[model samples]
Target: MSQAAADTMDNTHAAEHGGHHGEHHVLPYTVYFAVYGSLLVLTGITVLVSFAGLGKWSIPVAMAVAVVKASLVVGYFMHLKYDDRLNSLILVVTLLFILIFFAMTFSDMRTRGMIDPVEDNMVLRNEQAAEKAAAAEASGESSEKGEEAHHEGAAEH
Candidate 1:
């Protein structure tokens, strides 16, 4: 083949196959509007939840709504839905690690009192005793200096 024909063929191949290599813009105008609308609705729900005074449920509800909104933004606006499989896998793995970390933290919190309840109290008492000792030392040093001053005054008289 001529060099010109080869160049044209290469360009055509790139045009066809390059979609997967970069961010693919797939959704149209109406889809973008819908995504934005859903995001706004989620925001409103979060705000309403904040006002509802459900106590503990408030945080869970707000968090759930926020997660949904984040998923929408990630899958649509950020083009994660059209992203490469490796990128999707990385996101999933990252989320899994975060969940594992949270799970471990909660596990520790749940079992904290079971191991030895005295440890916590001992820590508090030790802190209090250290403070008391420091205060007493300061007061004793001041009183000794005052007495020494009195003795010097008596000697001068």
Candidate 2:
């Protein structure tokens, strides 16, 4: 094989011939620059979104940008795009598991108050009690009546 033709291969077959034995992939400078530029743009987008007051959508938007940035770094810098298919598959599966775990944890956190409002939602319970106390005061009910009710409930416990 010609010298140029021989140098183009990056597989085990080429490694056996002492050709590109150590370097599996060799991308040009332009690819690295493009990846770097994309990462910078995504970072800018993340910052803008934070100040944009997107409210509930900001987290999802930032996560999307972050995922893109991570993909570029993993694919180009880590050379996972040119690596074995099995390696890529393993990475994808691991990420999916992590996503599932975070989703489940968030779901549980959001539902804890519903599962036991009095105990799990102490702040909400306190706010509700304060509102009741205010309403009683506004309706011209004696403060002692409210205190007695509170003490009576505490005594029942």
Candidate 3:
């Protein structure tokens, strides 16, 4: 076949088959809207949990919701779910490493006072000081009230 005919045949073959080596996953508009709605709902949940007074669990809860939103974005919007296995594996490995790093950091934070007692753990000490000041002020107020009563009795006489 001539060169022009060969080029035309390759183009026709690519068109007949999937475009760009079948790597692309053409998603519908509905799928994108669904993912977007899910993300919005998760965001609202995160806000509610913040106001719900989870206290120490607040950070973990927010992080969990964020991870879910990220997964949806990666799998649907980025099309990593329909992507190559190798690409997905790379993402998983990266996340695992990140998890390990954060775990080590938090463990270190928790174990800081092991070698020596932490001197600046002042929450209890501050509360004690406040209590002492309040007690002293209460006694002073009682003495002032006694003096006021004595002055009134002398004036009545």
TM-score, one value per model: 0.59, 0.59, 0.59
lDDT tens digits, residue span 15-118, model 2 = 44545435656666677887899899889989988999999998989989998999999987897765666678899999899999999999989866655444
**Among all candidates shown, the one with the greatest TM-score:** 1
Tens-digit lDDT string for candidate 3 (42-85) = 99999999999988999999999999999999987886765666
Model 2, residue pairs in steric clash: none
> Mind sharing the TM-score for model 1?
0.59
On lDDT, the candidate that comes out on top is 2
Ranking by lDDT: 2, 3, 1
CA-only RMSD, every prediction: 16.0, 9.2, 17.5
Candidate no. 2 TM-score = 0.59
Model 1 backbone overlap count: 0
TM-score of predicted structure 3 = 0.59
- Show model 1 residue runs off by greater than 4 Å: 1-19, 117-157
